[model samples]
Target: MIQKQNPENERIKRKFFAYLQGPLGRDEKTIQKHADAIAWFEKTTGHKSFKKFHIDQATKFRTQLQTATNARTGKPLTASTMDGQVRMLKTYFVWLSQQHGYKSRISHTDAEYFNLSRAERRIAHTPKRKQVASLQQCKRAFDLMPSATLIQRRDKALFACFMLTGIRDGAAASLPLSCVDLDEALIYQDARLMQTKAAKTITSYFLPVDPAYEVCFIEWVSYLQNELLFGHDDPVFPKPEIAVGENGFQVAGLSRDFYSNASKIREVVKSAFTSAGFAAFAPHSLRSTLTRWADKHYSSREAFKAFSQNLGHESVVTTVGSYCPVDEERQGELIRGE
Candidate 1:
């Protein structure tokens, strides 16, 4: 049976969403996740009114969340997943405890019931092994990518660009040709012009990867400028233009416009890696690869700091703490003084 939503809950949810977007400065995707978390709590309570919110309800929700299964994997939700969802709910309820009608009913301390056990919290915070490509693996993938047509050339260039510069997928998707400097080997990820994380303006220098990757990227840029007559304002990686052909709608050539999002860029990266007989590595994994590379090559602290800054990280600690997780094999080797 379909459970009916409380009108009061819906009204307050809209207000909370606005608070998230306006006051909290959350993006649409993040706001949606917050909404989903709230909805999950509502579902647990049979769409009960916020005015009726109690400590027991939160306890019940947390207990159910512990055993919840992921719809996609058909496996029990991971500690991390449950942790995130619970945290979101806990935050929401804490906020609710201060709101007008909810203040008297929901105590601030009541939200503590949503927390996981100490052991579960520790497990949730543990970082999992990330899938990062080797520099050689990236080179092999780049070499194997066919560059027969303009689309193929673009695909190959895009793959090379990711390796040559550890730019995020969103930034790369919206990057303008003018932002790229072939002579300087730099990328100006200007937030005013392109999509950057947290609207940060980053100055990224191309990493010293394979020279072949740089050559491929340079040739692609030259082709766009000289042969295609593409202007500086055009997208660095434009979507393919679709036109009606004998077989129906088909890709004609490069479009002058930027992609609406980074979905296509991720697809290209995944295809390139998989086709080259490697596990499908997302564009973000390339950042990890670069981080690992920096760990090995940059002997001096100053050089490593500069390298971290080039990757758009404010602090070297942020880069190391987030990206430089040693695999178990490497950890074992290090322990043995190998």
Candidate 2:
């Protein structure tokens, strides 16, 4: 049976979305996640009115969620996903309880019930070790890939670009030709034009790697400028071309426009790694590699602070806490040296 929309719930959601967008200044992605969380709650409750919510309803929903299985995996939902659902719901109810009409019915204190137990919260918050490719591995991946055709060259260059600069994949996909200075070896991540995290305009210098990696980047840029006659306003990394084939539309060559999103770049990363006989690493993992590299190269607090800023971190602590987890091998070396 299809669940019908609840008009009252819809109205409340609209108001809530407005509140999040305007007063909270949330980006669209955050707003959409909140909206999705609310939609799940509404579906579970048979599309009930928000005004009719009670503490028992919250408790029952929490119980239901604990038993819920992921549609794709057929396993119980992960603790972190459960935690996100509860957090969003709790925030929503807390806001609702303060509203004029809801104040009479819903108590703000009741919102606390939409929380995971202490143990579960700990599991959700714990950081897991991520896979990061070393500079040598990145070079191997780039060198191993075929670069005879236009698309192959683009894919190889794309991998090299990520390894060279450690720019976020989103920023890389949307980067304009003007943002890169081949002579200076600088990338001007202009947030106004590129899709940077939190719209941050970052000035990132090329990390010291094998000179061969820099050559890959420089040659790719030169191809776009001298051979292709691409102007500075064109995308630094353009999209793949589409052409009709016997079966259907097929990727033929390179498009002359920027990719609207980072999905293609992610695919390129996955394929490049798979071809080079390594476990796949996401583009963001390269940032961790760069951070760890910086940790080794810079011992002075002031120098580390500059390194943090180059990665667009407002505080050095943010870089250390989030990305500087020492591997067990490195930890052992430090202990042995001491």
- Note the Cα lDDT for every prediction shown: 0.89, 0.85
Model 1 RMSD vs true structure = 1.8
C-alpha displacement of 306 in model 1, angstroms?
1.4
lDDT of 1 at 268: 96
Candidate 1, residue 51: how far the Cα is off, in Å: 1.6
Please write out the lDDT profile of model 2 over residues 282-316, one tens digit for every residue.
88888887888888888899988877887889999
Residue-pair clashes per candidate = 0, 0
Most accurate candidate by lDDT? 1
Off by over 4 Å in 2: 1-3, 244-252, 332-338
Q: How close to the true structure is residue 114 of candidate 2, measured as C-alpha lDDT?
A: 92
Error of 1 at 78 (Å): 1.8
Off by over 4 Å in 1: 1-3
